[model samples]
Target: MSADDSSATARDSLDGGAATLTTRRLRYLGAALATLVALLHLLDPNHGLLELFALLYANPRVLVFDPRPAAFVVSATALLVGVSLSRNAPNRRPYYVAGIVVALTYVVGYLAWHLTGHGGFLPGREPLLHGVAPVANVVRHLTSDPWAAASMASELGLIATLVALLRRE
Candidate 1:
């Protein structure tokens, strides 16, 4: 259009290039949050990568049996996939929706695992219906453990960022 119109469009944050720039910035934020969640899961002092490192230090072959690390690896991989999809996929809605659901599952799963009597074991473990409540134990654990709390918060932040990206798209 005219020079004046071009100048007005350029100045308007919601217009054309400005709007694209805003979307790009949002993508970057989402990517960073996703990456943070992944790193926290891997490198948190509480467990996983740190423990794995210890195991490696002692004897690489003597790695103890712990399924939790596998779970973290899977979760981190899914988050990384989401980050990739957000940037490059042509039709991202299907993947984005799946990613949102996966993220939600992780958050809810963490709560459920802690709130259930058998925090570690599956299926057969009975619920903690007697004595101290499961919920209380989880709350205490989260409050007392800064690393766990930070990891949970990062997961939440990642979820929110994914939701924002979905809405923007």
Candidate 2:
């Protein structure tokens, strides 16, 4: 293999430090996962770019209270931080930590908002009674809520890959 190719693959630090896929490949996977998460948020059916557009169309002032824009901002920032961490060495731990934190935040935030209340679209709505069953909530998100399923899956993937990358340090 070429020098660059050889260096990129190195010994994977994860999975019992097994000689598996190249570290470079793992990094690529991490980046891809991050991109997926960002895209998922960008295209979120309820709280995505389209929703933002609609909010703006309906009433500019409403944007202040809309969560869609905030989601977009956070997603974009996570993507940037994930990419930055995977790009080079030295002081990368921070980036990995930030990326992980962001992913965790999204996952936790989703569960809290939905599980606790009858969350709704822009202008927001809260759950009146109580949260959903954890098992049922996950199942619904995985099966019925297409956008949510995609986002959650990607966020989980991002977390895994980032952790793998971080271990390489």
Choose the strongest candidate by TM-score: 2
Q: Per-residue lDDT of 28-129 in model 1, one digit per residue for the tens?
A: 877887788878777756456766667668766543334456566677777777778667765555665776676677678778777775344464455663
Residue 130 alpha-carbon offset, candidate 1, angstroms: 11
Give lDDT per model, in order: 0.68, 0.69
Worst 10 residues of 1 by lDDT: 61-70
Q: Clash totals for all models, in order?
A: 0, 4
Find the candidate with the highest lDDT and give its number: 2
lDDT, candidate 1, residue 8?
41
Question: Candidate 1: misplaced stretches above 4 Å?
Answer: 1-16, 50-66, 118-131
Task: Please give, for residues 109-128, the per-residue lDDT of candidate 2 as tens digits.
Answer: 77765665434433455443
List the candidates' TM-scores in order.
0.70, 0.70
- Estimate the TM-score for candidate 2: 0.70
